[model samples]
Target: MHAHGGTRSGDAVPGDEELLARLRAAPVLAGPLPEFDPAAAPDSPGPLFAAWLTDALEAGVPEPQTMTLSTADADGEPSARVLILRGIDSADCAFVFASDARARKGRDLAANARAALTWYWPAHGRQIRMAGPVTALGEDAVRRDFLGRSEAARAAAFTGTVSEPLTGTQEYDRAFRAARALVAAEPDRVPDTHTVYRLRAREAEFFQGRADPFHTRVRYVREGRAWTRTLLWP
Candidate 1:
Protein backbone atom coordinates (compact mmCIF):
# COMPACT_ATOMS: atom_id res chain seq x y z
CA MET A 1 0.00 0.00 0.00
CA HIS A 2 3.00 2.28 0.18
CA ALA A 3 2.76 4.58 -2.83
CA HIS A 4 6.47 5.26 -2.90
CA GLY A 5 7.11 1.57 -3.63
CA GLY A 6 9.26 1.37 -0.50
CA THR A 7 8.68 -0.99 2.40
CA ARG A 8 7.49 0.65 5.62
CA SER A 9 8.76 -1.08 8.76
CA GLY A 10 7.04 -4.47 8.35
CA ASP A 11 3.82 -4.74 6.35
CA ALA A 12 3.11 -1.94 3.88
CA VAL A 13 0.61 0.69 4.92
CA PRO A 14 -1.74 2.81 2.79
CA GLY A 15 0.26 5.72 1.50
CA ASP A 16 -0.15 9.15 -0.06
CA GLU A 17 -1.98 8.24 -3.28
CA GLU A 18 -4.89 6.50 -1.54
CA LEU A 19 -5.30 9.38 0.90
CA LEU A 20 -5.06 11.86 -1.99
CA ALA A 21 -7.75 10.00 -3.92
CA ARG A 22 -10.05 9.94 -0.91
CA LEU A 23 -9.51 13.65 -0.35
CA ARG A 24 -10.30 14.41 -3.99
CA ALA A 25 -13.56 12.44 -3.84
CA ALA A 26 -14.85 14.25 -0.78
CA PRO A 27 -17.47 16.99 -1.28
CA VAL A 28 -16.20 20.51 -1.92
CA LEU A 29 -18.27 23.35 -0.44
CA ALA A 30 -21.67 21.68 -0.91
CA GLY A 31 -23.69 24.49 0.73
CA PRO A 32 -25.14 27.72 -0.63
CA LEU A 33 -23.13 30.91 -0.06
CA PRO A 34 -24.53 34.40 -0.16
CA GLU A 35 -23.47 36.54 -3.06
CA PHE A 36 -20.24 38.42 -2.36
CA ASP A 37 -19.60 41.81 -3.87
CA PRO A 38 -16.05 42.76 -3.11
CA ALA A 39 -16.52 46.38 -3.96
CA ALA A 40 -19.62 46.68 -1.80
CA ALA A 41 -18.07 45.03 1.25
CA PRO A 42 -17.47 47.34 4.18
CA ASP A 43 -14.10 49.10 4.16
CA SER A 44 -13.09 47.38 7.35
CA PRO A 45 -13.07 43.62 7.81
CA GLY A 46 -14.71 43.96 11.24
CA PRO A 47 -18.13 44.96 9.91
CA LEU A 48 -17.94 42.41 7.12
CA PHE A 49 -17.07 39.71 9.61
CA ALA A 50 -20.02 40.78 11.75
CA ALA A 51 -22.38 40.61 8.77
CA TRP A 52 -21.18 37.13 7.78
CA LEU A 53 -21.36 35.99 11.37
CA THR A 54 -24.98 37.17 11.51
CA ASP A 55 -25.80 35.24 8.36
CA ALA A 56 -24.15 32.14 9.73
CA LEU A 57 -26.11 32.50 12.93
CA GLU A 58 -29.41 32.88 11.03
CA ALA A 59 -28.50 29.91 8.80
CA GLY A 60 -27.91 27.75 11.85
CA VAL A 61 -24.33 26.95 11.02
CA PRO A 62 -23.19 24.77 13.88
CA GLU A 63 -20.43 26.30 16.03
CA PRO A 64 -20.14 29.36 13.85
CA GLN A 65 -17.75 30.97 16.30
CA THR A 66 -15.37 28.04 16.50
CA MET A 67 -12.03 28.88 14.90
CA THR A 68 -8.56 27.42 14.48
CA LEU A 69 -5.83 29.19 16.40
CA SER A 70 -2.31 28.90 15.05
CA THR A 71 0.75 29.73 17.06
CA ALA A 72 4.45 29.10 16.81
CA ASP A 73 7.24 28.46 19.22
CA ALA A 74 10.30 30.63 19.60
CA ASP A 75 12.13 28.36 17.21
CA GLY A 76 9.44 28.97 14.56
CA GLU A 77 7.78 25.55 14.75
CA PRO A 78 4.04 26.02 14.35
CA SER A 79 1.00 24.33 15.89
CA ALA A 80 -2.73 24.76 15.53
CA ARG A 81 -5.86 23.68 17.39
CA VAL A 82 -9.58 24.37 17.51
CA LEU A 83 -10.96 26.86 20.02
CA ILE A 84 -14.22 28.72 20.48
CA LEU A 85 -14.26 32.39 19.58
CA ARG A 86 -14.85 34.16 22.87
CA GLY A 87 -15.52 37.54 21.28
CA ILE A 88 -14.72 39.89 18.41
CA ASP A 89 -14.49 43.59 19.19
CA SER A 90 -14.42 45.75 16.08
CA ALA A 91 -13.74 48.85 18.11
CA ASP A 92 -10.63 47.33 19.61
CA CYS A 93 -9.74 45.58 16.34
CA ALA A 94 -8.99 42.38 18.15
CA PHE A 95 -10.20 38.76 18.31
CA VAL A 96 -10.29 37.29 21.78
CA PHE A 97 -9.86 33.79 23.23
CA ALA A 98 -8.72 32.38 26.54
CA SER A 99 -6.01 29.88 27.39
CA ASP A 100 -4.23 28.50 30.39
CA ALA A 101 -0.98 30.44 30.68
CA ARG A 102 0.73 27.25 31.80
CA ALA A 103 -0.01 25.39 28.57
CA ARG A 104 2.32 24.89 25.63
CA LYS A 105 0.49 27.52 23.57
CA GLY A 106 0.94 29.96 26.37
CA ARG A 107 4.63 29.24 26.43
CA ASP A 108 4.75 29.57 22.67
CA LEU A 109 3.04 32.93 22.83
CA ALA A 110 5.40 34.05 25.50
CA ALA A 111 8.28 33.36 23.15
CA ASN A 112 6.49 34.80 20.14
CA ALA A 113 3.69 37.32 20.47
CA ARG A 114 2.17 36.79 17.02
CA ALA A 115 -0.48 34.29 15.93
CA ALA A 116 -3.17 33.57 13.39
CA LEU A 117 -6.87 32.69 13.67
CA THR A 118 -9.12 31.22 11.04
CA TRP A 119 -12.88 30.58 10.96
CA TYR A 120 -14.53 28.33 8.43
CA TRP A 121 -18.30 28.06 7.97
CA PRO A 122 -18.52 25.35 5.35
CA ALA A 123 -22.30 25.40 5.55
CA HIS A 124 -22.14 28.76 3.81
CA GLY A 125 -18.86 28.36 1.89
CA ARG A 126 -17.26 31.23 3.79
CA GLN A 127 -14.06 31.72 5.72
CA ILE A 128 -12.37 34.46 7.74
CA ARG A 129 -8.69 34.72 8.44
CA MET A 130 -6.78 37.03 10.78
CA ALA A 131 -3.17 37.24 11.77
CA GLY A 132 -1.32 39.70 13.94
CA PRO A 133 0.53 40.34 17.17
CA VAL A 134 -0.94 39.21 20.49
CA THR A 135 -1.53 40.95 23.80
CA ALA A 136 -2.27 39.31 27.13
CA LEU A 137 -5.33 40.97 28.57
CA GLY A 138 -5.39 42.44 32.08
CA GLU A 139 -5.75 40.18 35.13
CA ASP A 140 -9.20 41.57 35.92
CA ALA A 141 -10.50 40.42 32.54
CA VAL A 142 -8.94 36.98 32.97
CA ARG A 143 -10.58 36.57 36.38
CA ARG A 144 -14.01 37.38 34.98
CA ASP A 145 -13.63 35.00 32.04
CA PHE A 146 -12.54 32.15 34.33
CA LEU A 147 -15.28 32.68 36.90
CA GLY A 148 -17.88 32.77 34.11
CA ARG A 149 -17.07 29.20 33.02
CA SER A 150 -19.05 26.15 34.10
CA GLU A 151 -18.00 24.21 37.17
CA ALA A 152 -16.20 21.61 35.05
CA ALA A 153 -14.45 24.25 32.99
CA ARG A 154 -13.48 26.15 36.10
CA ALA A 155 -12.08 22.96 37.57
CA ALA A 156 -10.11 22.24 34.43
CA ALA A 157 -8.90 25.80 34.27
CA PHE A 158 -7.82 25.60 37.88
CA THR A 159 -5.51 22.77 36.85
CA GLY A 160 -3.92 24.25 33.75
CA THR A 161 -1.33 21.56 33.07
CA VAL A 162 -2.82 20.04 29.92
CA SER A 163 0.18 18.74 27.96
CA GLU A 164 1.79 16.84 30.81
CA PRO A 165 1.35 13.08 30.86
CA LEU A 166 -1.25 11.82 33.33
CA THR A 167 -1.21 8.51 35.17
CA GLY A 168 -4.78 7.80 33.97
CA THR A 169 -8.31 9.15 33.63
CA GLN A 170 -8.98 8.17 37.23
CA GLU A 171 -6.19 10.49 38.31
CA TYR A 172 -7.71 13.36 36.35
CA ASP A 173 -11.23 12.61 37.59
CA ARG A 174 -10.03 12.65 41.17
CA ALA A 175 -8.21 15.94 40.68
CA PHE A 176 -11.12 17.47 38.76
CA ARG A 177 -13.60 16.52 41.47
CA ALA A 178 -11.36 17.95 44.15
CA ALA A 179 -10.92 21.18 42.23
CA ARG A 180 -14.65 21.38 41.56
CA ALA A 181 -15.43 21.05 45.23
CA LEU A 182 -12.91 23.74 46.14
CA VAL A 183 -14.34 26.06 43.45
CA ALA A 184 -17.88 25.43 44.73
CA ALA A 185 -16.79 26.76 48.12
CA GLU A 186 -14.99 29.76 46.63
CA PRO A 187 -16.49 30.97 43.33
CA ASP A 188 -13.68 33.46 42.82
CA ARG A 189 -10.92 30.84 42.59
CA VAL A 190 -9.43 32.07 39.35
CA PRO A 191 -6.03 30.54 38.75
CA ASP A 192 -3.11 32.95 38.47
CA THR A 193 -2.20 31.32 35.12
CA HIS A 194 -5.56 31.74 33.43
CA THR A 195 -5.33 34.39 30.70
CA VAL A 196 -7.39 35.97 27.96
CA TYR A 197 -5.21 36.85 25.00
CA ARG A 198 -6.28 39.18 22.23
CA LEU A 199 -4.95 39.12 18.70
CA ARG A 200 -4.79 42.70 17.44
CA ALA A 201 -5.06 41.96 13.76
CA ARG A 202 -2.58 43.67 11.47
CA GLU A 203 -4.68 42.30 8.60
CA ALA A 204 -7.86 40.31 7.99
CA GLU A 205 -9.20 38.46 4.99
CA PHE A 206 -12.68 37.37 3.93
CA PHE A 207 -13.16 34.50 1.53
CA GLN A 208 -16.40 33.54 -0.21
CA GLY A 209 -16.62 30.41 -2.32
CA ARG A 210 -18.25 30.43 -5.74
CA ALA A 211 -19.73 27.96 -8.23
CA ASP A 212 -16.66 28.30 -10.38
CA PRO A 213 -13.13 27.59 -9.26
CA PHE A 214 -12.54 31.31 -9.23
CA HIS A 215 -13.93 32.32 -5.84
CA THR A 216 -13.86 35.66 -4.03
CA ARG A 217 -11.23 36.98 -1.63
CA VAL A 218 -10.90 40.39 -0.02
CA ARG A 219 -8.08 41.33 2.26
CA TYR A 220 -8.09 44.31 4.59
CA VAL A 221 -4.76 45.60 5.74
CA ARG A 222 -4.62 47.87 8.76
CA GLU A 223 -3.25 51.35 8.23
CA GLY A 224 -3.12 53.11 11.58
CA ARG A 225 -6.65 54.41 12.18
CA ALA A 226 -7.76 53.40 8.67
CA TRP A 227 -7.71 50.18 6.61
CA THR A 228 -6.76 49.47 3.00
CA ARG A 229 -8.62 46.81 1.03
CA THR A 230 -7.34 44.58 -1.72
CA LEU A 231 -9.03 41.99 -3.94
CA LEU A 232 -7.06 38.80 -4.50
CA TRP A 233 -7.38 36.44 -7.44
CA PRO A 234 -8.95 33.14 -6.65
Candidate 2:
Protein backbone atom coordinates (compact mmCIF):
# COMPACT_ATOMS: atom_id res chain seq x y z
CA MET A 1 0.00 0.00 0.00
CA HIS A 2 3.08 2.26 -0.10
CA ALA A 3 4.54 4.13 -3.04
CA HIS A 4 8.12 3.29 -4.08
CA GLY A 5 9.64 6.73 -3.31
CA GLY A 6 7.05 8.88 -1.47
CA THR A 7 6.70 8.96 2.28
CA ARG A 8 4.21 6.25 3.11
CA SER A 9 4.00 2.89 4.85
CA GLY A 10 7.31 1.02 4.35
CA ASP A 11 8.35 3.57 1.71
CA ALA A 12 11.74 5.29 1.62
CA VAL A 13 11.94 9.08 1.83
CA PRO A 14 11.87 11.03 -1.39
CA GLY A 15 15.25 11.66 -3.00
CA ASP A 16 16.50 14.99 -4.36
CA GLU A 17 15.09 14.44 -7.86
CA GLU A 18 11.72 13.35 -6.51
CA LEU A 19 11.60 16.33 -4.21
CA LEU A 20 12.52 18.66 -7.04
CA ALA A 21 9.80 17.19 -9.22
CA ARG A 22 7.21 17.65 -6.51
CA LEU A 23 8.33 21.21 -5.99
CA ARG A 24 7.92 21.98 -9.67
CA ALA A 25 4.43 20.52 -9.62
CA ALA A 26 3.27 22.65 -6.73
CA PRO A 27 0.35 24.97 -7.42
CA VAL A 28 0.99 28.72 -7.54
CA LEU A 29 -1.42 31.63 -8.05
CA ALA A 30 -4.17 29.11 -8.61
CA GLY A 31 -6.78 31.45 -7.32
CA PRO A 32 -9.60 33.74 -8.31
CA LEU A 33 -7.16 36.64 -8.36
CA PRO A 34 -8.28 40.24 -8.53
CA GLU A 35 -7.62 42.31 -11.64
CA PHE A 36 -4.99 45.02 -11.60
CA ASP A 37 -4.53 47.86 -14.06
CA PRO A 38 -1.14 49.56 -14.06
CA ALA A 39 -2.57 52.66 -15.72
CA ALA A 40 -5.04 53.14 -12.87
CA ALA A 41 -2.38 52.85 -10.20
CA PRO A 42 -1.88 55.87 -7.95
CA ASP A 43 0.77 58.47 -8.72
CA SER A 44 2.77 57.36 -5.72
CA PRO A 45 3.48 53.77 -4.66
CA GLY A 46 2.64 54.43 -1.02
CA PRO A 47 -1.08 54.75 -1.70
CA LEU A 48 -1.08 51.75 -3.99
CA PHE A 49 0.78 49.70 -1.39
CA ALA A 50 -1.77 50.79 1.24
CA ALA A 51 -4.59 49.66 -1.03
CA TRP A 52 -2.99 46.26 -1.63
CA LEU A 53 -2.38 45.86 2.08
CA THR A 54 -6.06 46.55 2.69
CA ASP A 55 -7.03 44.04 0.04
CA ALA A 56 -4.80 41.40 1.62
CA LEU A 57 -6.30 42.18 5.04
CA GLU A 58 -9.86 41.92 3.71
CA ALA A 59 -8.95 38.65 2.02
CA GLY A 60 -7.89 37.21 5.41
CA VAL A 61 -4.18 36.93 4.65
CA PRO A 62 -2.30 35.94 7.78
CA GLU A 63 0.29 38.43 9.04
CA PRO A 64 -0.41 40.88 6.24
CA GLN A 65 1.74 43.53 7.91
CA THR A 66 4.81 41.32 8.11
CA MET A 67 7.70 42.08 5.74
CA THR A 68 11.14 40.74 4.99
CA LEU A 69 13.75 43.35 5.92
CA SER A 70 17.05 43.02 4.06
CA THR A 71 20.18 44.74 5.28
CA ALA A 72 23.82 44.61 4.37
CA ASP A 73 26.86 44.75 6.61
CA ALA A 74 29.82 47.12 6.17
CA ASP A 75 31.53 44.44 4.11
CA GLY A 76 28.56 44.35 1.74
CA GLU A 77 27.31 41.06 3.13
CA PRO A 78 23.52 40.92 2.92
CA SER A 79 21.10 39.43 5.44
CA ALA A 80 17.36 39.33 5.82
CA ARG A 81 14.71 38.56 8.41
CA VAL A 82 10.94 38.80 8.69
CA LEU A 83 9.43 41.33 11.06
CA ILE A 84 6.26 43.31 11.61
CA LEU A 85 5.82 46.66 9.93
CA ARG A 86 5.47 49.12 12.81
CA GLY A 87 4.01 52.02 10.84
CA ILE A 88 4.20 54.13 7.69
CA ASP A 89 5.07 57.82 7.39
CA SER A 90 2.51 59.28 5.01
CA ALA A 91 4.37 62.52 4.43
CA ASP A 92 7.51 60.98 2.93
CA CYS A 93 6.41 57.39 2.21
CA ALA A 94 8.77 55.98 4.79
CA PHE A 95 8.36 52.51 6.33
CA VAL A 96 8.99 52.31 10.05
CA PHE A 97 10.06 49.49 12.35
CA ALA A 98 11.61 49.14 15.79
CA SER A 99 14.61 47.09 16.82
CA ASP A 100 17.45 46.97 19.28
CA ALA A 101 20.53 48.90 18.25
CA ARG A 102 22.65 45.97 19.41
CA ALA A 103 21.02 43.56 17.01
CA ARG A 104 22.72 42.40 13.81
CA LYS A 105 20.29 44.32 11.63
CA GLY A 106 20.91 47.51 13.55
CA ARG A 107 24.65 47.04 13.16
CA ASP A 108 24.20 46.43 9.46
CA LEU A 109 22.07 49.53 9.06
CA ALA A 110 24.58 51.53 10.99
CA ALA A 111 27.29 50.59 8.51
CA ASN A 112 25.30 50.82 5.25
CA ALA A 113 22.47 53.24 6.13
CA ARG A 114 20.41 51.55 3.43
CA ALA A 115 17.92 48.68 3.53
CA ALA A 116 15.13 46.99 1.66
CA LEU A 117 11.68 45.81 2.71
CA THR A 118 9.60 43.24 0.87
CA TRP A 119 6.03 42.18 1.57
CA TYR A 120 4.40 39.17 0.01
CA TRP A 121 0.76 38.17 0.50
CA PRO A 122 0.59 34.85 -1.31
CA ALA A 123 -3.11 34.49 -0.69
CA HIS A 124 -3.74 37.73 -2.56
CA GLY A 125 -1.02 37.05 -5.16
CA ARG A 126 0.56 40.40 -4.50
CA GLN A 127 4.01 41.67 -3.51
CA ILE A 128 5.50 45.05 -2.62
CA ARG A 129 9.19 45.96 -2.50
CA MET A 130 10.79 49.14 -1.23
CA ALA A 131 14.42 50.08 -0.79
CA GLY A 132 16.16 53.26 0.30
CA PRO A 133 18.28 54.96 2.90
CA VAL A 134 17.40 54.19 6.52
CA THR A 135 17.60 56.71 9.33
CA ALA A 136 16.98 56.49 13.07
CA LEU A 137 14.02 58.43 14.42
CA GLY A 138 14.53 60.92 17.22
CA GLU A 139 14.71 59.93 20.89
CA ASP A 140 11.07 60.85 21.46
CA ALA A 141 9.90 58.54 18.69
CA VAL A 142 12.11 55.71 19.94
CA ARG A 143 10.78 56.09 23.46
CA ARG A 144 7.19 56.13 22.22
CA ASP A 145 7.75 53.02 20.13
CA PHE A 146 9.30 51.15 23.03
CA LEU A 147 6.63 52.24 25.51
CA GLY A 148 3.89 51.22 23.10
CA ARG A 149 4.99 47.56 23.28
CA SER A 150 3.26 45.14 25.65
CA GLU A 151 4.63 44.33 29.08
CA ALA A 152 6.12 41.01 27.97
CA ALA A 153 7.70 42.63 24.94
CA ARG A 154 9.12 45.39 27.08
CA ALA A 155 10.63 42.80 29.42
CA ALA A 156 12.17 40.94 26.49
CA ALA A 157 13.64 44.16 25.17
CA PHE A 158 15.15 44.89 28.58
CA THR A 159 17.19 41.70 28.41
CA GLY A 160 19.39 43.28 25.77
CA THR A 161 22.64 42.01 24.17
CA VAL A 162 20.74 40.94 21.11
CA SER A 163 22.31 38.59 18.52
CA GLU A 164 24.64 37.22 21.14
CA PRO A 165 25.10 33.47 21.39
CA LEU A 166 23.04 32.16 24.29
CA THR A 167 24.97 30.26 26.91
CA GLY A 168 21.91 28.53 28.26
CA THR A 169 18.14 28.86 28.55
CA GLN A 170 18.36 29.06 32.35
CA GLU A 171 20.43 32.22 32.17
CA TYR A 172 18.05 33.83 29.70
CA ASP A 173 14.98 32.80 31.71
CA ARG A 174 16.44 34.25 34.90
CA ALA A 175 17.21 37.56 33.22
CA PHE A 176 13.79 37.64 31.52
CA ARG A 177 11.96 36.92 34.78
CA ALA A 178 13.81 39.71 36.56
CA ALA A 179 13.13 42.06 33.65
CA ARG A 180 9.44 41.15 33.81
CA ALA A 181 9.33 41.98 37.50
CA LEU A 182 11.04 45.30 36.85
CA VAL A 183 8.61 46.07 34.03
CA ALA A 184 5.67 45.28 36.29
CA ALA A 185 7.03 47.62 38.98
CA GLU A 186 7.90 50.45 36.55
CA PRO A 187 5.78 50.28 33.44
CA ASP A 188 7.26 53.48 31.99
CA ARG A 189 10.78 52.05 31.78
CA VAL A 190 12.17 51.75 28.24
CA PRO A 191 15.34 50.13 27.05
CA ASP A 192 18.09 52.50 25.99
CA THR A 193 19.04 50.22 23.09
CA HIS A 194 15.55 50.22 21.62
CA THR A 195 15.30 52.44 18.54
CA VAL A 196 12.82 53.20 15.81
CA TYR A 197 14.07 53.52 12.25
CA ARG A 198 12.48 54.76 9.05
CA LEU A 199 13.45 53.84 5.50
CA ARG A 200 12.65 56.71 3.15
CA ALA A 201 12.00 54.79 -0.03
CA ARG A 202 13.80 55.93 -3.18
CA GLU A 203 11.90 53.35 -5.22
CA ALA A 204 8.95 51.01 -4.81
CA GLU A 205 7.66 48.15 -6.91
CA PHE A 206 4.26 46.46 -6.86
CA PHE A 207 3.81 43.01 -8.36
CA GLN A 208 0.50 41.32 -9.14
CA GLY A 209 0.74 37.65 -10.02
CA ARG A 210 -1.66 36.20 -12.52
CA ALA A 211 -2.78 32.64 -13.17
CA ASP A 212 -1.56 32.92 -16.73
CA PRO A 213 2.00 33.51 -17.87
CA PHE A 214 1.58 37.27 -17.91
CA HIS A 215 2.34 38.79 -14.51
CA THR A 216 2.05 42.49 -13.64
CA ARG A 217 4.94 44.57 -12.31
CA VAL A 218 4.60 48.28 -11.71
CA ARG A 219 7.67 50.18 -10.55
CA TYR A 220 7.82 53.69 -9.19
CA VAL A 221 10.94 55.77 -8.90
CA ARG A 222 11.31 59.07 -7.04
CA GLU A 223 12.98 61.99 -8.77
CA GLY A 224 13.14 65.14 -6.68
CA ARG A 225 9.53 65.63 -5.51
CA ALA A 226 7.95 63.75 -8.42
CA TRP A 227 7.38 60.03 -8.93
CA THR A 228 7.66 58.24 -12.24
CA ARG A 229 5.78 54.99 -12.80
CA THR A 230 6.70 52.36 -15.32
CA LEU A 231 5.73 48.80 -16.22
CA LEU A 232 8.33 46.04 -16.27
CA TRP A 233 8.26 42.94 -18.44
CA PRO A 234 7.15 39.96 -16.49
- Please tell me which predicted candidate would have the highest lDDT against the true structure: 2
Evaluate model 2: give its lDDT. 0.89
Which 10 residues in a row give candidate 1 its minimum summed lDDT?
155-164
Q: List the residue pairs that clash in candidate 2.
A: none
Q: Pick the candidate with the highest TM-score.
A: 2
Per-residue lDDT tens digits for candidate 1, residues 27-134, read: 887656678989898878888888899999999999887899999999999999998888789865689999887788898999999999999998889989999999
Q: Once all C-alphas are superposed, what RMSD does model 1 give against the true structure?
A: 5.3
lDDT of 2 by residue, 1-234 (tens): 444745576657789999999999998887778899999998998888878888998999998878999999999999999988998875577999989888999999988999999998888788899999999999899888888888999999877488998899999999999999999999998787888999999999988999996999999999999799999998
TM-score of each: 0.90, 0.92
Query: What lDDT score goes with residue 45 in model 2?
Result: 85
Task: After superposing candidate 1 on the true structure, give the runs of residues whose Cα lies further than 4 Å from its correct spot.
Answer: 1-20
